[model samples]
Target: MTKMKNESNLKVTFCKRKSGLFKKFSELITLCGAEILLLVFSPTKRVFSYGHPSVDEIVGPLFGYPVRRVEKLMEVEEQHGKKINHDKKVGQDQRWWERSNKEMSYQQLEHLKMSLLNLNAIVTQKMLEFSNP
Candidate 1:
């Protein structure tokens, strides 16, 4: 009976801590003008989540775990801006590979290089089609 009671208390403590962390995350987002989405699964496989704007919209992408779509869209806009201001491209946004180099291990660097090569191949194929047409 004592062991069962201790287990129940531990579960309650876990729930409270999770709720507190989510509340703090919400406050930070509000104060800093940021968007955040979080998903958590308990040991029992129950789900808890929080998202600024709406939980429904962010749900699909968090589950999929790609580089959040909104962030990618912003990067596209920044790249367009840089293209237009090619002569004065100071302080332009950095690509993912550029930003990642600071802390990347050697293995990660090699992987990133391979991914960049793949991206170049895809882009070159599209460019070839444009040129031929």
Candidate 2:
């Protein structure tokens, strides 16, 4: 009925719930011979996904998905990556948390947020003893 207020317990709960949830997904696929794609984003924006057979196989055609735009998108992403690589801080590597929000576009800002989320998830999961997070 209420969100868990304790951070330590909440993180532990997250790991347990994530494990049980993924196990159920696997069971559904195996028992029913189902084709399923699951994408879960936690409260911190960490990404977790499960796809049977494969995500591409189970997902439908994008319905007039722009292949041309995908090429352009890849090119843009490549350039962005190069920019980040070159924009290192004076004494240390530039981290997502260190980047200035004002310089980022809305999409970039979102990507930054997700990166941080993933990083936080990794750190939390690693710091804990359990294998799942």
Candidate 3:
């Protein structure tokens, strides 16, 4: 009975420390904008982690501590995903446009050409309508 009680107390301490570490990890990530992954196994054989992409994806390749390229690729992937998700949410949603009435004026000639082509189509449509009337 004493051994069981000791084991139980140990478990409770382990759980509390694990939760505290997880919270600290999250806070560090939030404050520093660094990609971090932690792998912890308790005495009872449990796994825990905290990271942006994942602990394994970040840490497994170079035998712990991912190379700079890997971290950069992960960041790019995350940014791309965020952009795609934002586009999906903002597309056809006038609420976003209403909040930020902004447009990027940085233009490429290719984009300008496409815009001109669209304008031509609209002009042609209007001319056809007038002629028909």
Candidate 4:
């Protein structure tokens, strides 16, 4: 099993493994002409999903999904576009140091280093507990 030292490391590993899994899933579907629907929930309760052809195509009808009209679909798309734009602007507005560690003061860097080490110890203990149980 892959081990994570801290929350940051865990998150990074999750993203990398998630992307790799999705790529493999895509290859499997393409090579075998298979339908695939995958849903994963992170330890933090966030979701990641991948579906071949379309998510709706595989899971919608079975659940008696509603067929949305063009107007409703368009509205949803507009809202999603707005959300994306807002997130982009927020990211762009963050201070340089907030986005990177290069500008951190010595004290700040030391604090962060200690915090990461503490987190690593906590996570390691939790993993041991889970494994023993």
User: lDDT per model, in order?
Assistant: 0.55, 0.59, 0.52, 0.58
Ranking by lDDT: 2, 4, 1, 3
Q: Indicate the worst ten consecutive residues by lDDT in candidate 4.
A: 91-100
Candidate 1 per-residue lDDT, tens place, 44-108, comes to 65555556754434543544433354455435545654544463337944343334357654644
Backbone clash pairs in model 1 (N, Cα, C under 3 Å; residues 3+ apart or in different chains), count: 0
lDDT of 3 by residue, 3-38 (tens): 345778888888778777877887787799778866
TM-score of each model, paired residue for residue: 0.39, 0.46, 0.41, 0.49
Candidate 4 error regions (>4 Å): 2-5, 69-133
The backbone clash count of each candidate, in order, is 0, 0, 0, 0
Give per-residue CA lDDT, model 2, range 1-133, as digits (tens): 7999998888888877986887798889889999887766676766666667643344324333233533454455557656765665567545543445576556557665554454344434433423343
Q: Compared to the true structure, candidate 1 yields what TM-score?
A: 0.39
- The sequence of per-residue lDDT tens digits that candidate 4 reaches over residues 1-133 is 6677699989888877877787799889989999997877676865555666755455555554443532354355457545544554354543322334566556445544554344344334433554675
In model 2, which regions exceed 4 Å deviation? 60-133
- Number of the top lDDT candidate: 2
